[model samples]
Each structure stands twice: as structure tokens, then as C-alpha cells.
Target: MAKDFNENDRLIILNLYRTHGDHYTNFCEEFGYNPKCAREIIRHAIKSNGVELNHGEWSEEEVKKLKKVVRSLMKKLQLQSYDGIPWSRVSQKLHRSDVQCRQKFFSKSTLFKMIPKNQIDGWNEKLDIAKFIALLKKLNFPDYNMIDWDYIKEKFSSNYFNILLRKWREMRIRIPNHQHLSLYEIVDHLYKTRVLKLFGDDPEKMKEIDDFINT
Candidate 1:
């Protein structure tokens, strides 16, 4: 018999969908569940909660709308601001940790269901498409010793880093452009990427990353 999932588990599954997408295949890979079971949950959500995945088997107009929503939602997660929401700042405004804000503001099912097909005019249209790419760059190719986890913990608090640490675990993102990077040499790269967003981007800060990685 399949065990019933708790609300938290359900939220994790839902977030997996939101973070990844509605395709049952990604769900199975990330959550270690059969794709059929994952798809069934999605179907159940649609029936009971009005949640839908905007699957491809729809009318052209409907499919276009769904695809638009799918693209936007993926974009939203990577944003510093969306529709002027300053989603990254929502944690400070709500007086919660990122993880807490995620749980309270975005119920997993809600996150999955709300991916907008037709971008409403008010939401952030000018959102940066470069942040995650930059993030991955910072992770994979540390050029600057600009990362500082202690400062990140101080500025954003432990909960912030903790939440991201969970993501780091889930995604297993690591220093990729390492011609010389060992595991300990990699911590500085991790620090710069996760900790000091403001100061890390300067090209001058990269000297330490070069020195540390080369040493």
C-alpha cells in the first residue's frame, strides 16, 4: 500500500513540480517516485483543487497560453523581482525565512497551479534573465574570492543560507570550471555565489578566486 504524504511532503512534491515542471519524468527523477504516481497526484489536484499542468494535448490557443505560463513560472523562480513583487525581498517583508516564506506564501499546489500562460501586464516583464546564469557562473567558475558565507549568514540570517543549502543539496550545484579546484578550494566559490551578491560581481574581486583555486 502507498503511504499517504503529509502536507510538508506534498509541499515538497509540489515545489519540485514548480521548480522543475509538470512533466512527470522530472518529478520521478527528483523525488524518487514513479512518474505514474506523480502524474496521478497532478490529476488529483486538477480534479479536486483546479490545478492543471497545461499539458500539450490542448487546443492551439489553449496550448499557447499554457506554454506561456510554463515559461513565465520558470522565469519567476530565477528572478530578483517579478511584476515588481521583488520576490527575493518578500522574505524580509513577510518577516520570515526564505523557507518559511516559501511555505506560507507559496503552497506547493498553488505554485504549480498558478503558472501564468498569458503574462498579465502588471507583473515584471523586465525581469533579469541573467541571474541564474550568473549564479551558475559563480558556482562553476569562481574567478573571485568574493564569496563569504559568514557575511551571508549575518546579512540574511542562518535560515536564508539554510534554505539555499537545501537547494544546493537538491541540485548538487558545484564548481564546474575548475581546472585547479579541489574540494576545499571550492568553498570560496560557494561562498561568493551564495553569500555576497553585491560585492562579488566586481571583476577585481576575482583575483582571490584565481589564487585560491590555483594554490
Candidate 2:
């Protein structure tokens, strides 16, 4: 007789289904269960979660609406992490499944363009050296040299790290009489001034600050 799965087990099966892209054979092999049992567990999990499988092509209007909703949520929550997004709330507004909404949002370059130019300006206004330090500490890389640029790029879903770093450098360089200060002291001075803002209006000055820091 096949063992009955509990709620937790069903959730795990559902997650596995998503991860494996509906590969029942992989699920069976992993759980030592038959394909029929695996399919039943997944179906039950989907139904119990009230997640509608609306696998239809999204319209242009829906895409625009999704961007608007996400932008609003980002500003409201001061969202820092992509995973922290409330997909359930988004789905409720869009009348789509949470999985569908999430998958759609990440399918192309949609996430990168979700932040408006005005929002970028808003961020620049509120940003300061102290906040930058706090963010660095929060990301567990307080030291500029210790930061994993690739990891940060992937985490924020942004490819503009070079531009961001160049902006930071420009802000740092603006402090007068800083030529005599050591790298560490310059960082401390910026912390004291609390006037540094990341990301300049111009994108042409972007260069890899990683190379500068590493050397």
C-alpha cells in the first residue's frame, strides 16, 4: 500500500514538481514512489493551495499592469530582496496564480525595467554613506574589498554594478582635501560626512570599481 502524504510532504512534492518542471519520473526516483502516486500528491497540493494553473499567454495589458503593481509594492515596502516580493498579493490583484506571476516577471528583462526613473531618483535622494554602510553590513560585506560583485549583481538582478561603483567613486572623490587621506580614512571621512549618493545621472562613466578595489 502507498503511504499517505501529509501537508508538508505534499508541499515538498509540489516544490519538487516546480523545480524539476513536472518530471514525474524524477519525483518517483527521489521518493521511491510510483509516478501515479507522485502525480496524485502534486495534484492534491495544487488544489489544496488554491493555486490556479492559468498557463495562458499573458497579454500586453497584463504585462503593463504587473509592472505597475510591482513598482508600487517596491516603493511601499522599500523592497531590498527579489525573494521578499509578495507574489500572493500580486496574484490576487492580477487574477493569476502566484507561480505564474513570479515566472512571468522573471521570464525576460522585465524585473530590471520594473524600477522607474523617478524611483531611481527617489533612491538617490535618500541614499547616504551611512545608509550605504548599513546596506553593506546587512549584505554581510561591510568591507568594500570583501564584497562579491557577482553575488550582489545576481541578488539585485542588476547588471549595472560598474555604473553604481563609478558613481560611488565620483561621490567619494568630490570630498575636498581627501588626497592626503588613506583609503580606509577616506571611507571613514565619507561615513562622517554622510553625503555620498550612489548612481549618477550619466551612464558613460561606468568602469569596474572591482578592479580598483582589488588592486
Candidate 3:
């Protein structure tokens, strides 16, 4: 007959499975347990207890710890994308899953707080009039839904597409009679009159205009 396992025994079996991986059956044999019985107990425990997960709102300390661990791992691994983060390892430290850790880190509120103000401001400033005009010309002043946001993000090296969309809407509001003007007409008008004063002798802006014109 199989032994009646308590909570402690269940935990032991689960730990053994975690530590021994696929060879856990061998470890169970060494410990005088029927391998099949041990496996059954582990399956039941995992179903009921969820790999010892602590599911609820994250504590402030946990948030701080997550930030620290992610930064260390990213630097050590020289990771470029968030997908490269070893969330399984992070979960071992934080008692969270890779999915949970990733979701928390990339959640809009958390991401907003994590990004530096200067960096956000820099992204905001990137869609200047020259670039906006250039993009409008290239895209043929397509409607917001018609724009290929992923292509725009890649081409402009911008982090967030929503920001770009917002900036475009705001820019359109600033333009006079924008609804009636074709992109070429708008550029010709801006170049002939408004562009110089709007840029105000900024050499970088002049260079951007020259580059756009040449292209």
C-alpha cells in the first residue's frame, strides 16, 4: 500500500522533482519511495499549490528586488531585448514565474516608472517637425489606422508606437488647414515660408531639412 503523505511529504517530493529534474525517479528510488507514487504526489501538489507560488499584489520590496535582479542580469548577459531576460532564474530568486516577472516588468505603469524622465523626454523630442514632415511624405499622409506602426517604430528607432501616434495627432492639430492639404503642398508651403523660422537657424534642423530635400 502507498504511504499516506502529508503536506511536508508533498513538499519533499516536489523539491526532489525540482532538484533532480528528469532523474527524480532515481532519487525517489534511493529514498525508498515507489517512483510512480512519488511522481503522483508531485503532480497533485503542483496542481493544488502551483509550484509554491505567492499570487497576490506585489510588495514594494519585491518590486525593488525585481528591479535590482533584472538590471544585474541584463548587464551580465548583455541583453538587448526584454525577451532575453532569464525570467526562470529571476523566478527562482523572487518566487515568481517567468511570465509573472516579465508581465510585471513590462506593465505600462511599471515601465513608465522604470524609464528615466530624460529618456522619455528624448523620445518625445525625436518626432520633430522635419522628421514628422518626412514621415508624412513617405507614408503619403495615411490615416492613423493605415500607418504601419511597427515599420515606423523600426525605421525611426522609436521605442513606443503610441507616442508616435499621439505626436502625429498633436502635430496635425497644430497645422492650419491640414485636412485639405496634400503632403507635397504642405511641405512646399512649410519649406518656402514656415520651416526656416520654425527651425530658427538651428544648424541641426537645417541639416535635417537639407538631408530630407536631397533624399
Candidate 4:
């Protein structure tokens, strides 16, 4: 006896799928439901509210087009803010409210999906790695005496600086003998570790890292 999905559950399914494709696996993982059950909810949405899925909510085609527009705008330097995202322009192009556009684009689910796919195309991971390694060496690793986070933020985009640091810390914890490693060695170690593969294999991931070592 499967439980019936309420409107909220259906909306959750729709939102997750619209904002993060293949969300059925996540729904199953989060809710202890099997993939079949997770998928049934989406099927139910299509059958019961076909118009809503196609019109009110973003259809698959619409999301794809929106992603392209967002990508194009992000590449134009003049259109970006400090965070390097231009949500208002994205909203106008998508014909959706800015708030909604922002929520959908930066939502936890959306970012989770985007990172591995290389869909969020603006950040140069190479520069980020170079700057991060330089800072870590400058501070002499584990010493906070002269570390100024603001300077690091300036070196990397404010939106992603913290994430980069956190990633570095995570990498440090995973690998041993890091204390004696040079900056290049540390970067190489990070490349070998899971840190570099943060974006797993996704068929849609269009971008490849063209490593541009700044220093």
C-alpha cells in the first residue's frame, strides 16, 4: 500500500527535477523510497497536472535554455557582480522573478548538480588552486599568525573563496605527509586526490579544466 503524494510532495518533486535533473536518485536517497517510487511521483505530476509542469513550472526544455542564457551572461565581465553571477539578467531572460531565478540557480540541489557537470562555468579552478596553495604556504600551514582571509577573498571570488579553503582543508586531512610538501607538491597531491574529481562524470559536463598555473 504505497502512500499517496500530497501537493507539497509533488511540488518538491517538480522543483527538485526542474532545478536539479535526475533528482529521483536524491529523493530516494533522502526519503528511503525506492527509485521506482521516487519516479512514480514525477509521473503522477505529469499525468495529473500536465499543464502545470509544462507551463507554471519549468519544463526540461525551458531549463536547458535558461542554463544557456545564464552561462552566456556570466561570461560577459560587465554583467557580473562581486559574486560573478548576474541573476537579474538571468531573470529577465528566463521571464521569471529574480528571486525565483536566484533560488533555482543557487539552490543546494542546483549547485550540487552544477559543480560536477562543470555547468557553472565562470570560476577558474586553476587560478583558485594556485592562489590557495600560495596562501597556505605564505601562512606556513596550520599557522594563523599572519593569515588575512580578506586578502584571500580578494584573490579568489568572495562567493567561492571559503569553499576553496574548505576544500583545501579537506584535502589536507585526507593526505598524509603534507607538512613537508612544497606548494607544487601540494597542488599535485590535491590533483591526485578526490579533491580534483569533485565534479564526477556527468554526460552533460561540457567544460574541461585548462589548468592555468598563475605562479
Candidate 5:
């Protein structure tokens, strides 16, 4: 359990909060507490009128304003019509952290529904896993330690790449005698069962990805 805050701690909280605003990571580090604990303390302070905190849940009006700002930025940046929303701008306008903006935008209720269907499908996690498995098979189960992490990061976005590494490790442990199986067999086994149940079975995606090894 987190320790109860005392008078000195409350003073420190108000001071750091005034200095840091919503930059909770740095605030928590300096105050020797986790983000959850820091938020609780800050909220309590605000309740007691110790400090003013404007940041809160994004209202419907805020979401509408955000969409407008995003549309404007897309035009100025010359980003593709279907490109991902720029969370940095959203964070600045909303006075929230980039992670907070991203989490709010991509939460299940919003992400898949808000973005273009094709774009969402294109960034599917299974595709990355399928691609990784194909590479592993061709490399003959090469020592993961020998693999260059930088090169792997280049191949996939940071978030999906982490997922790729995790799933690949899990597959290596769960699927015994993997060396004896062809890439297609391994992919098929993973797809047919719930073990790695990829969300959608887009025929074109499967065909494009399954014709691997040579790539």
C-alpha cells in the first residue's frame, strides 16, 4: 500500500505539481511515487483547493475540436488522407501527455471505429507476427541473441515490434519441434487454433504474406 501523505508531503506535492503540470512521469520520479499515487495526491490537493488542475476527461466538445485540429494538421503536414492522427499536436492542444492522447484515441471504443477500415487492417498485429515467423524459418532458428535489435525496430513500428518479439518468444517455447515444420505449416497451425488467432482472415493479406521466404 502507498504511504499516507503528511503536511510536508502535501507541500512538496503542490510545489512539484505547479512546476510539472501534467508531466506526471517526471513529477512522480522526483516525488518518489508511482503515477497512480501521484494522481491521487494531486486530485486530493485540487479538492482541498491547494492547486488548480485543469486537465480532465475529454468532453464531446473537445473531441470535435480535436478532429478539426487533426484535419487541419493533416493538410499542412501533407500527410496521406488515411495516415494516423498526430498525437503530439493533440497533446499540446488538449494539455495532456502524448501517451494519454494516444490511449484515448486508440482505446477499443474509438480506434477501430474512428480510423479507415483498410488502415486498421493494414496495421494488424498478426501480419507482423506472420512476417517474423517467416523470417525465423528462413534464418533456420538463428540465435535471437545474435539478431540486431536495431534492424528489427526498423522493420516494424516500436509498439508492434515489441509485440512481435514477445509473440515470437512465446511461439518458440510453445511449439516444440518447430525446426521440422515449414513456415506455412507453422502459420497455418497458429491461425487455425486460438493459440494465435489473428483477428481477420483477409484472403489478399494471407496470400501476400504467405508467399514469404524469398522476401
Candidate 6:
């Protein structure tokens, strides 16, 4: 059982995230408390404020291993489109039933190489799992943290620090290496830039972008 934390401990962590620094690795190193414990404290703080956390699923290493195997098979079979092959065919390829693959992805009645591939990726991999999960809870559901994050990357060129810095740039104006700015403004700026190339409707480029933004 998680020990109920007192308000005082919550204040201490709030102060750390506020005053000292917000690095979980640093917080654990300094206080010698489990990092997960720190997260619980933050979650409690948010919950105390009546704000539920946003969350998303991510792939585990085991799932990644399976995905890599599937990707390899797809490449070998030249199966790039959704209609190209059926799961039954892939079952023969991998010796796994559809149920098994769904279990690996934490989903049911869903099929990949169809419309559910990105959802699977979202469940299993989040470019950077740490930020993605935090973002999920922070933003809650029915909000697009992924789009906000993507725009943040396109504008700032870095995930964490640059997000804070690049928020100051005016819309449609290019800054060198994304100077002081914030994420919200980044999305607005992208709309102004007409550079939808980053967010265009292309499948293969989108894949490369997912890899790029997450990698």
C-alpha cells in the first residue's frame, strides 16, 4: 500500500517542482525517495485540486520486440497497405492469433495496418514515454497533447527546455534554434507559417515524423 502522504510532504515536493527544479531524477537523487512516490505526490496534488490526470498507454519492450518482428515480416511480404494482407495471413506469418496481438497491444477488436496503428503506437510507444504519460494526465482526455507536442517540436526543435523557451516567438516568425517560447504559441505559429509539411496528410512522412519527434 502507498503510505498516505501528509500535506507537508506535498508542499515540499511542490516547492521542489516550483523552486528548486522539476527534474524527477534530480528530485529522487536529492531526497532519496522513490521517483514513483514523487509522482504519486504530484498526482495527489492534482487530484486534490479536482483535476484528474491525463494518461496514455505505451508499448513495452516485449511489445516492441513483437512490433519489430511484424514490421520485418511486412517488409518482407511487401505489405504496406491495409488491404494487402489479413491477420489470418499474418497469423501464419507469426504463428500468433489476432487475440494474441491484441493482448500485446492492450486492445481488443482492433487491427493494425488498418486505422489503429497509431493508436497501438500510442499505447505502446510515445516518442518519449516520460513526457507523453505526464502530458496525458496533465491535459486529460478529449485534448490533443500529441498535436501540441508535435507543434512544440516543430517550433522549438527540442522537447523539454526549448518548449518553455520558444513560446515567445511571434507567429510565422522564425527564430534561430527556437529562442525563448512556449508550446501553446507554437501551434498558433504553425498555423500561420503555412508549413503544413510537418503536419500534412501523408502517411509515410507521418511515420518518419512520428519517429523523428519521438526519437
Backbone collisions counted per model: 10, 0, 0, 1, 0, 18
Write one digit per residue (lDDT tens) for candidate 4, span 1-215. 12576666666666766666665557555755566765776654443323233326766676776667766776776543224566666665654655566556554444445454444356666545644654455445444445566666766554476356545655665677877766556655665443335533532321222222132
Worst 10 residues of 6 by lDDT: 163-172
**Superposition TM-score, candidate 4 onto the true structure:** 0.31
Give stretches of model 3 more than 4 Å off: 1-51, 122-215
- TM-score of candidate 2 versus the correct structure, residues matched by position: 0.36
lDDT of 2 by residue, 1-215 (tens): 22576656655666777777556457566766667777765553453355535446798889899878877887899975454579877876775777777777765356546545554453332343344433443455445567665665453324233234434565566878766755555566654555233433323311222222223
1 or 5, which is superior by TM-score?
5
Give the Å error, residue 3, model 2: 20
* lDDT values for all models: 0.42, 0.56, 0.63, 0.54, 0.58, 0.43
Q: Predictions ranked by TM-score, top down?
A: 3, 5, 2, 4, 1, 6
Q: Per-residue alpha-carbon lDDT of model 1 for 1-215, expressed as tens digits?
A: 11365656555666666666645456565666666666665544432333443222335454344335434654766633222233334433322333443443333233334434343222221111122223334445344344454443443223333334334433334457555664445545545544345435655544433442333
TM-score of 5: 0.39
lDDT of 5 at 43: 67
Report the Cα RMSD per candidate.
Answer: 15.5, 14.5, 15.3, 13.9, 10.7, 18.3
Please list all clashing residue pairs in model 2, or write none if there are none.
none
Residue 70, model 3: Cα distance from true site in angstroms: 0.5
lDDT of 3 by residue, 1-215 (tens): 23586657666777887887757888886767788888776554343335656546899999889888987898999964344578877876786766678778766556667666675765534425556555555566445446555555565534444344444555554679988876566655554444555674788876775675345
Candidate order, lDDT descending: 3, 5, 2, 4, 6, 1
Return the TM-score for each candidate structure.
0.20, 0.36, 0.40, 0.31, 0.39, 0.20
lDDT of 4 at 45: 42
Tens digits of per-residue lDDT for model 5, 1-215: 23576657666766777877777547676657676776776764453334353356788876666666666877888854323457767666665555565555545454445555654455656566766655554455345456655655666555555445446546754777887875556655665542234524566755655564355
Q: Which candidate leads in lDDT?
A: 3
> Once superposed on the true structure, which residue ranges of model 2 sit more than 4 Å away at CA?
1-51, 80-83, 115-215
